[model samples]
Target chain A: MITLTHVHKSFGDNHVLRGVSLHVPKGQSMVIIGGSGTGKSVTIKSVLGLVEPDSGRIEVDGREVHEGDRDAFLARFGMLFQGGALFDSLPVWQNVAFRLLRGALKRPKEEAREIAIDKLRRVGLRAAVADLFPSELSGGMQKRVGLARAIAADPEIIFFDEPTTGLDPIMAGVINELIREIVTEMGATTMTITHDMTSVRTIADRVAMLHDGVIQWEGPISEMDGADDPYLAQFIRGRADGPIEAVR
Target chain B: MSGLLSPVAALGRSMLALLAYVGRVAIFAGATVAHVFRPPWYWREFGWALMQIGWLSLPVVGMTALFTGGALALQIYDGGARFQAEFAVPSIVAIGMVRELGPVLGGLMVAARVASSIAAEIGTMKVTEQIDALVTLSTHPMKYLTVPRVVAATLAVPVLVAVGDSIGILGGYLVGVTRLDFNAAAYLKNTFDFLELWDVTSGLIKGAVFGFIVALCGCYFGMNSGRGAQGVGRATKSAVVTASVLIFAANYILTEVFFAA
Candidate 1:
């Protein structure tokens, strides 16, 4: 279970997250949907402790996220960045197995490579693609590699940032399906940040719509459709005119 | 009155910013040094950095030292001829190359090549979120990235300085015997007699210090670089400029401490 209580963050004069508070029960897929630059990434990063919140508390499993044994805390979570964030200097297999190559979770090189190849296969990548660099892969393949890397260590919690942003319709559908299967099969707790409405339909167990740094509407996906809140209606209908500024 | 006060305010701000930069760089350098002595060390990254920073930079530093030595010998011989003192060419050339020109020029060249590159590579990584990825992967970016580079530069530059000094002395020797019409045996004897152990040691020490400055500036600007292409470019340029200036400043300070009467 994860919860963010009155989390406030600001960069210079721009207040991105004013007072965001949300909760997701254990082993549930909670997807946060908001317009671009609305602190969606910052919200997830706060939980991961990548971006420090200006004020508020984020707790995972009733323990403060930033307290006691940082490495061990990070080890329990996996994140798939919007840009894939694969290391250019390393081959795909090495990038996927990066956590296993060094530091506390280090494994034997051969075993790490084997596990990397297996994860790659799970993400629909062939074994031979392991030797190539990230630049050599297509956008879809890179996202798959990023997904493979996020799940490489079999972390308890996985966060996905814009999993479908740059992908084609078919590729996006495939990624959504992969996310669904992984969540159901592993029974892992997940928090996905995305603007793609279709990904929300496929992957979310419960959906929370964030606006102006606060949760405006939250319910099971079945209830999201019937919700009468004007903000959620405006967003779900893809209207340019809404409480959320379109220009932002 | 307003115009005069505005400039004063601007000057104050600039001074404050410079002090802030100095403080940040000092702290970064301290963290990098602390990481070097701690465990979970990365040998492979350190080895690669040694090759990239030290071994790959040999040709440029060597060429700069060599040509400067030759030019110094020519200038000394010509200038000494005005007073009918051409015999001073070999000794003065050797001393100039070993004492001042060798480490300073070599440091500048490495700063241009190595510091700019380190900044660009690391700044790009920051933009693409690879640095955050490193953090989420449970690895400290300072340890994983900065330590190896600083250590490599610190160790490699002294060796580079030593080699550059030898080649520069050789350059002066070649020009002295052939172009200046000085006897080869006499030129060799004069060079050996005039150059002291302290002169070469001071240059090598300066080289090590310059290397530290280059690595520190590169890593500091890189880790603190803003986002996007412009940010990366700005960081690269800043790293080279700061490294070169610091090297020159350090050179002057070291000379005063080591040789001033």
Candidate 2:
């Protein structure tokens, strides 16, 4: 389980996250929907300590996120970045098995490779795709590779940052389905950030709409549609004029 | 009065900004050095860096040294001719190449090639969020990226300078014996005789220092790069420019320390 309390982050004049507090219970899929530059990425990054928050408390399993050993802390979680963020220098399998090839989670080369191929298969990728570089793969294939890597280590918590942003509708649907199926099968706690309403419908068990650096509304997916909040309604309906302005 | 004061204020601001930039680079270099001695050393990354920063730079460094040495030989022979000291050509060429030209030119060449490549590569990685991915994967980006490169360049560029020195002397020898019509054996003897152990060693030491500067500039500019393709382009340009300028400045200070009376 993960919890963020009163998280506030600002970049010079831009106040991104202002008193953002949220929780994702153990093994639940918490999808955060927000417009561009609403600090959705920064919120997750703050929890991961990639971006230091100006004022906040982030905890996993009731322990401070920044406390104790960093390597151990990070080992509990995996991330699938918006761009896939696969290392171009490495082959696909190496990227998938990166954590396994080095540091605390290190395994033998053959064993790591085997696991990478297995994860690739789980993501519907062929074993032969393992040796090719990330650039060699198609956009959908790259996203699949990123997904494979995120789940490769079988982490307790997984963060998907805009998982289907750049893919075509069909490919996006495939990724959304894969994410939904995988999250259910693994029973891992997940926090996904995206503006894709379709993805939210498909993957979210619980939904939270983030706006103006705060959680405007949050509840079960079923409640999201009929929520009385105008901001939530405008966002869900893709309206340009509403309580939430179209442009910032 | 306000107009006159504005220039002074601008100068003060520029000075402060320059100081801040230097302080940041110093901190980055210090952290990189600290990571070098820590455990979980990424030998694979270090080895790869060594190959890229060292082995791959040979062709450009060699060509630069060879041409410069040949040109130095010709100039020395022509100038010495007026002073009735044409015999100084071989010794001067050898001493100049080994002492100053070898490491400085080699370092500059590596800076242009390796520094630009490193800055672009790391800057792109930063933009793509691969750096954050490294962090989430339980790896320190500094350990995984900067330490290997800085250490590899520090250890490898001296060897490159040494190789460049020899090739450069060979270039001079070819010119002296054939073009300048000097006896081949005599030219070789004079080159060997004029070169001191300290001269070659001093250049190698400069090579190590220059190597450190080049890689540090690349990594520093890269890790601190702003976002997007334009940001990466700026980082690459800054890396090469900073590495080159620092190499020249370091070379001068080192020369003063080693050879000044």
Candidate 3:
């Protein structure tokens, strides 16, 4: 389980996160929904130690992550970045097996390649594509490769940052389904940050709406449509005029 | 008048912003160095960086030295003839190449080729969010990406300087024996006699420092690069310019310290 307590982050004078708190119990999928630039990504990055909070506490599996142990803490989690950040110089297989190829998790080259190929297969890619570079693949294919790389080590926790941002609806649905399947199979604690309602409906067990740097509403995916909160209602309906627009 | 001052104020703000960014870059470069000696070296990335920054840079470094040596000989002979001290050509050529031109021009050529390439490659990766990806994957991007290149550059440039110095002297020898009316044995003797251990050592030392500067500027500008094509272009240009300037500056300082007499 990962817990964020009173997380506050600011970029100069812009207070992106103001006393934000959230929790994801083990083996649960928690989706954070928010408009762009409302600190959704910042929140996830803070948990992963990508963005150091100005003041907060992020605890992973009962281990408190302060200043010095971020790398050790992050090793327990897998993340799929928004743009599918695969290394271009490396072939697809090596990109997937990067962690396994070095340091404490070092494995023999052939064994690592085998593991990478299996992950690729799990993500619905052929063995041949493993030797190709990320640039050689289509956008949808790249996302799948990113997914394979994320799950290569079978992390205890997973983070998906804007997983379906640029994909077509069908591809988005496919990725969401894959995320759902992987989370269920691995029984991992998953936190997905996305603005897409379709993704929330497909992948999220519980959805949390982020507004004004705070989680305004959170509940089961089934309860999202019936949410009585005006913000949630306005967001779900995709309306032009609501309490949200009035703030502008 | 007040309206006109607004542009000047904006310019000042931009300069201050740039200065702050450079300060952050220096801190990041120091962090990269601190991570370098730590365990968990990325041999795959290190090997790739060796090939990219060093081995592949050979042709340009070699060619620049060869041609510069040839030109230096010709110019020295021409100038020496006017003073009736033409006999000093071979000795002067050897000293010039080893002392000043060999490391300085070699560093600049590398600054042009290797520095720009490093910046562009890493800058594009930044724009594409590969560095962010590394961070997300429990990998320190500086340790994985920048350290290897910096190490490769630091270790490789000294060897390059030694090779370049030899090739440059050979170029002078070739031009002197074939084109100029000079005795091969005497020219070789003069070069051997004029070249001292300190001259060559100083150049090699300069090479190492210049290499660090080159790789540092490249990685620093690249990691802090803005997003887009223009951002990459700016990063590449700044990397080369800063590397070249630093090489020249370091060359003078090292030379002064090594041979102040």
Candidate 4:
């Protein structure tokens, strides 16, 4: 479970988040949808303490996000980066088993490899692909590898950033389905940020729409369609013109 | 009056920005040093960096040292001939190659090669969010990336400089014996007798400092680079230029420390 209270962030003159607050209940799939540059990624990053909020409180399991040990705090979470973010110098297996192979959770090399292969299999990747570099993989395959890595340590919380971006429709659907299955199987709380409406429909149990640095509307997916907020309606409908300016 | 004051104000602003950036780099350097002593060290990354910053740099450093030594012998021989002092060539060449040229040239070569590669690699990583991924995975980027590289270069470049110094002395020997018509025994004797252990140690000490500067500039510019392709390019360029300038400046300061009364 996570809660953000009155989070505000800014970069120079451009204010990104202003007094934005949201709560995610435990083991729920909460996807934040928004237009480009609506600070969706910043929100997720703020909770993870990657982006320091100017004024706010972020709590994970009732403890402040920045409190306690960093390694212990981070061990509870995993993230699938937008670009997969695999180390080019490392082979696929090493990338997937990165945390397992090093730091506090270090395991024997063989054990790490075994777990990496198993996670790859869980993400529908062949065991043989483990030795290849990230550059050798296709975009969809890379996303799957990112997925495998995110779930590698069996984290209690997983964050997906633009998981379906740059994938073909079919591949996107496959990733969405895999995400749904993994979240259910692990019972992990998730906070994903994406502009993809289809991904929201497939993966979200509850949805929040971000606009103008605040959560404009948020509720169950069923209620999202009928939400009267013009900003939310315009966003879901993919309109170029609305109360929200097309260009910022 | 406003027009004349405008240029002064602009200059003042630029100077402040430069100082601010230097302060940031100083803080980053301090943080990197702090992380170096911490646990969870990445030995694998350090080994890779050693190979990149040390072993891979051998051929270029060797070649530069060789050419510089040969050239130094020729110039010293010609210059000594003016006062009928051509016999002093061996001692001069030995001192120059061992005490100055070896480490300076070797450090510059490594800076050009290793520094650029590190800046480009890490800069691109930063832009692509691999660095962010490292943090998310509970790995400190300073430990995983910066400390390994800085430590590797600091340790390895000295060894490289030692190797370069030997090859450079050999180059001077070959030139002095063959082309300069000096007897091989006499030339060898002069080289050995004129050189002190302090000379070699000082150069190697300079090498270590130069190595630290090179790697620190690379990693610093890289982790602080802006966004996108142009940002990476700028970081790479800045790394090389800054590393080169620091190497020269450090060389002078060290020379004064080691030799000046």
Candidate 5:
């Protein structure tokens, strides 16, 4: 449902995405694995048009991302940022129902609140938690709230940016499991970027290893373990000494 | 020879950077004004901004005006005593507070309080990706954030200046009666007689311009802030500094335009 063709981006001397090309079919979970600063975030952001690519094309559902009404285009997708990125001034329910309370997807205030609570419950958060601010919640609960928000509008596509970063192992596992279950239930096309191997195993139907500003390897999750690519081998094994450099 | 040219090159580079910075800020201001006229106005956000930039700012602005007015009364009384012109205290205090001190000091105080806060809040939001989150949620960050604030300050600061001017004149009145031993009714009469409509209106116009500069500096530095806590700190500092300097500079130009012969 989403496609990026030979996309290139740079920030002065840093050529973050040299020429990245990838595609995710409808209703599939595509987890992009890459080390820090390999342009994984930039890749997803390019598709979302959050960060405009210097060159090349990005399309979602067969239309250019930057061509049509921005509000309408963005309405079809949701995102969970690494920092949760919930509005600090808003309560959890308001954050979850943000899109539903504004713009084209707007609903009545009462209906929006009810849907926010329902989505909160779907992510294992109690309805009581809906009144609390983001800063009042723990990191794990904040992540769940963010997840609830990502799925709140029942968007066709969802992007999870490092969904497991800064969480304890148990919390990370729970988030990964919740993501897998929710993505499956919603039948939503998803693009998740993370270096968390456990999250990759639990959440990805397909995996793409990104390195050196390009996709080094991609296939089904089952084939990722035995892929003969040296860079993929170095990454999945977590070896310090290999084709992937340990030092910058 | 290269050493001799190095300083000249550095000056040229600094000039270019300053020009570029001014250009970017002008464009940002233009875009914010454009968004203000467009549809999809977020009244909730606008209401909150009005509360922050207007209502909440009253205490500091009031206190500053009061103290400055009292001090100006004392100085005028003392200085006028030397030339047998002590009775001129009331008129001078009223004119000074209404024309020069009211909007300028009020704008500076708001710049310190509001500009820094706006910058820090928006800068941190940018760092944490709330801005990008807003975008993905089909909200324009400019419309949702900047327009409300700029519009609020533009509309609200003039009101603040008017309030501050009255309170400041009251302060002078109190000092002239209680401490300077002037007749209360005569003091108020002189204050009213000397203050014209243009004196107060000119200050209000300056207030609006200063308010625009304060919020614009805050939003501009904030939206363009770099990453992390340190970046937010830098943005806050830059916002206050820019707003304060702009207030003074704008105050001078405005005074020249209003009162110059």
Candidate 6:
């Protein structure tokens, strides 16, 4: 399980995260939804120790993650960045098997490549795509490759940042299905941040809405539509005329 | 009064932003350096950096040293003729090339080529989120990205400098024997006798330090770059300029330390 307690982060006068907290139980997919610049990314980064919180504690599997031990703490988790940050210099298989090809967890080159091809197959990609660079692939294919890399290590914790931000609706649906299938198969604890309602519906077991640097609403996905919170209602229905301002 | 005060405040704000960015870059660099000595060194990345920082740099380093050595011999022979010391050509050329010209020029050449390439490559990766992806994959970006390049530069620059020194001396030998009417054996003996261990060692040390600065500036600016084409371009330009200037500055300081009479 992943737990955050009373976390606060600020840059200059702007407090991006303010005394906020949330939790994701083991084998559950928790999706956080919020408007752009609403601290959703900051919250996830803080958990991963990418962003240090000024005051508060983050714990993964009951061990508190200290600021100094970020690498050790992060070893158990896998992340999917919003932009599908594939290495342009590397071919798809190398990008997928990047972790396995070197460092402490490294295997022989052929073994790592095989694992990469297997992960690619799991993400519904053809083996032929394995040798191509990221520049050659379309947007949706890149996302699939990113997903393949994320699950390649069989990490206990997975974080997805805007998994469907740039894809066509059909492609988005495909990615959503792949994420759902893989996360469920691995039984990995997952935290996903996105604005897409379809992704939230398809992937989230529990949903949290972030606004003004705090959790405005939190509940199971089934309860999201029926919830009476105005912020939740405004966000879910995508209405223009609501208490949530269109501009700051 | 209000206009002057507001402008002052804006200037202070910009200065503070710049300082903060520098601090962040320092912290990132420190983290990378620390991880370099740790257990999990990225060998694949290290191998790639060795190729990028060392092997590919050979042609530029060789060409620069060869031309500079030839030109120095010509200029020295011209100056020596005025003093009736034309026979001092080969000795002076070898000493000058080994001590200062070869390593400094080689470093600047590499700064122009490798530093900009690293910056543009890493900057493009940054804006595209490849570094972020590395982070999410349970791979420290520092270990995977910066450490390899830093190690490669530190280890490879000395090798490059040594090769350049040899090639440079050879260029001078060629010029001295062919154009200056000096005997081949005499030129070779002069070069061999005049060159000292300190001259070559000092040049190699300068090369290593310059290489570190080049890679550091490249990785620093690249990772700190903003997201877009404009940001990558700025990073590349700043990395090359900063590396070249730093290389020259370092050369002078090192020269002072090594040879001050």
* Model 5 quality (TM-score): 0.99
| Interface DockQ of each model | 0.91, 0.95, 0.65, 0.88, 0.96, 0.54
lDDT of 6 by residue, A1-248 (tens): 88888899998899988888898888999999999999999999888767789998888878877645665566678888888888888999999998888655779999999999999999989999999999999999998998888888788888999999989999999999989988888999999999999999999999999999989999999999999999989999998878899863
Candidate 3 per-residue C-alpha lDDT over A1-248 given as tens digits, one digit per residue, 9 for 90 to 100: 88888989999999999888888888999999988888999998888777889997888776766656666666778889888999988899999998888755669999999999999999899999999999999888999999999999888999999999899999999999999999999999999999898998889988889888888898988899988999998887788798786455
- List residue ranges in candidate 2 displaced over 4 A: none
Instruction: Residues A120-225, candidate 5: write the lDDT tens digits.
Output: 9999999999999999999999999999999999999999999999999999999999999999999999999999999999999999988999888989999999
- The predicted structure with the larger lDDT, 1 or 4, is 4
Tens digits of per-residue lDDT for model 1, B1-261: 998799899999999999997898888888888999997788999999999999999999999988888888899988998999899888888788778888899999999999999999999999999999999999899988899899999999999998888888788888887888889999889888988999889988998999999988898889989989999999999999999999999999999999999
Q: 2 or 6: which has the higher TM-score?
A: 2
DockQ of 2: 0.95
- TM-score of every candidate: 0.97, 0.99, 0.93, 0.98, 0.99, 0.90
For residue A147, what is the lDDT in candidate 3?
95
Q: Where does candidate 2 chain B have its weakest 10-residue lDDT segment?
A: B186-195
For candidate 3, lDDT tens digit of each residue in B121-174? Answer: 999999987887887676777888889999999988888888889899999999
A3-115 in candidate 4: lDDT tens per residue?
98999999998899988889999999999999889899999999888999999899999999988999999988999999999999999999999999987888999999999
lDDT winner, 4 or 6 = 4
The alpha-carbon lDDT assigned to residue B49 of candidate 1 equals 94
Range of the 10 consecutive residues with the lowest summed lDDT in candidate 4 chain A: A239-248
For model 2, the docking class works out as: high
Task: Give TM-scores of the second chain, every candidate.
Answer: 0.96, 0.99, 0.92, 0.98, 0.99, 0.91
**Residue-by-residue lDDT tens digits, candidate 6, B1-261:** 998799899999999998996788678768777887896777878999999899999999999999888889899999999999988988898889878987898888888988899899989988887777677566777677888998899889889988998899889888888888899998889888887888888888998898888888888888888769999999999999988988888988998999999
Write down the worst ten-residue block by lDDT for model 5 chain A.
A239-248
Evaluate residue B71 in candidate 1 and report its C-alpha lDDT on the 0 to 100 scale. Answer: 88
Per-candidate alpha-carbon RMSD to the true structure: 1.4, 1.0, 2.8, 1.1, 0.9, 3.2
Best-to-worst lDDT order: 5, 2, 4, 1, 3, 6
lDDT of each: 0.92, 0.94, 0.88, 0.93, 0.94, 0.88
